[model samples]
Target: MFISISIPLADETRVRPYTIASSPEDGDLFEIVFNRVPGGAGVAWLFERKAGDEINFTGPFGAFTLERAPERELVFIAEGTAIAPIRPMLRRVFEQKPGHPVRLLYAADRVEHLLFRGEIEGHAIAHPQFQFETIIADGGQEALYARIMAEVERRWVVTDNDRMRHFYVCGIGAGVLRIRDLLRGAGYERRAVRYEQW
Candidate 1:
């Protein structure tokens, strides 16, 4: 689908790539969720959009295209609205490899603020191999207590096939880097990790 997006400014013009947050079959109009950050370029405008406002964008770009292959396991790590790319990937993966092992770990400031929780949960129920863990930064749950970098290391066991599993991570600059380092340290082959930086 093609869209023409207009924000509060002109210089930001360009059809930025964005995964349709809503299900693709849901139709032409879709939502792209984002947090308002201090001096944030794209997000600042995105968060302020009113209902029915026209925004220009062409997608689903990058190497993160949503497609499925039964041979590979999937690991999705997302922070805030970075889930954009991961969400569509999951939908496509499930459609093709219904029983493939897929895990999604999303970090958020609070449980109430988690994005697409219901969708992820439903996916997990339908596909046993699909599991989701929500890490609330301020929550007391053990899974939510540690930083994302440490958590990835603690969970994944490095093996000869570590290079085979697909890893998708997106978020703030620092968090993305830290997770990359952790993955490398955990014996994940450098070539195995795919990252999208915001």
Candidate 2:
């Protein structure tokens, strides 16, 4: 869903849209992740925030809620910074479906490009039901495809081919769609894969 964050200026306020990264289970506060752009006004404005600073942001609006795929395995694919929205969704899976198998394939150009790397890796370490893989896409398209394909095949070994499955892809622009396509081409139903949208 979309969240409106406002930067208060002397005579006016500027607003930007960011995805909500917290689930209702996370309590009253909603978390959002953003990076500083090279020459971005909003980035500059947001960076000036202090720990106790107050910023104007509104709503956790969206229909991209998590579902209980009890009859199927749940797979999440995230690219670069898309982990922001997927974080709480993944958390919900852990909360609502205790023993279910959940797999996450997150890709970035480099280790430094990954967000919440430690957090996600730590979660996977603590939870045996969840499997995680990181793909460094700097190795070219063919290499990236091979890595993801291997991970998918590995998951298939444990996952029932006859059982239904749901795939969630979250990332910037075409990246998410490309992942969706990969999953679809791998024999998953078109309707089973969901991607983040504008």
Candidate 3:
């Protein structure tokens, strides 16, 4: 499901490829979530978008997708806006197998900064097989206050069967590095983990 979009050049330079967040059944509109960085062209342009605005993009271009494999558990680890893709992937996963053991660990600076928190909770509450955990890096609350590394390690390697579950981590540069290191330490079998770091 690929479409071309005409995103305005926020930095007067380039229009980056952003995974449209909307599900294919949702129709013609493509939803994307991004933050404005200091010099990020895509984010800058995306920030100025209004309803009815036009943007250009190419693809459906990720090798990563939610394929039904009920025998295997799955884990999604996202930081900040990276949850956009995870959201859709979860939708696909649940649609195919409502009771599959899928864990979502979303890390953010604060609860307010957590994207799709309500939606995550709703899914967890509605489905017994879906589990959701949030780690706040700001330490402003009693909830998991560890960095992503510490928080993520809790579930990286499922010891029950010694079978490394599928792991996906998405975030910025340093955050991605930390996740990779954490997974490596957790004995995740390397190949079972997929990552997308901005």
Q: lDDT tens digits, residues 43-63, model 2?
A: 688888889988778775776
Number of the predicted model whose lDDT against the real structure is largest: 2
lDDT tens digits by residue: candidate 1, 1-198 = 113344546675533444456667668657666566677676666766787776655444446455555467878898767787677778878878654578898988777667888988999898899889877786532334257766677677542445557688887666687777777766677767878776
Per-residue C-alpha lDDT of model 3 across residues 1-198, encoded as one tens digit per residue = 223345655345564656666687788766776666677665766777788865566666765556654456788888777787777888888777644478888888768879878888988887798889877777532223246665565445443435557787777666676677667667767767777776
- TM-score, cand. 3 vs. native: 0.80
TM-score of 2: 0.75
- Give the range where candidate 2 is weakest over 10 consecutive residues by summed lDDT: 155-164
lDDT of 2 at 37: 57
Candidate 1: clashing pairs of residues: 4-55, 4-56, 5-55, 5-56
Candidate 1: Cα lDDT at 111: 75
Off by over 4 Å in 2: 7-14, 138-163, 185-187
Q: Show the lowest summed lDDT stretch of 10 residues, model 1.
A: 1-10
Give the C-alpha miss distance for residue 147 in model 1, angstroms.
1.3
**Once superposed on the true structure, which residue ranges of model 1 sit more than 4 Å away at CA?**
1-6, 10-19, 56-60, 139-146, 157-163
User: After aligning candidate 3 to the native by TM-score, how far in Å is the CA of 130 from where it should be?
Assistant: 1.5
* lDDT score for residue 7 of model 1: 50
Better of 2 and 3 by TM-score: 3
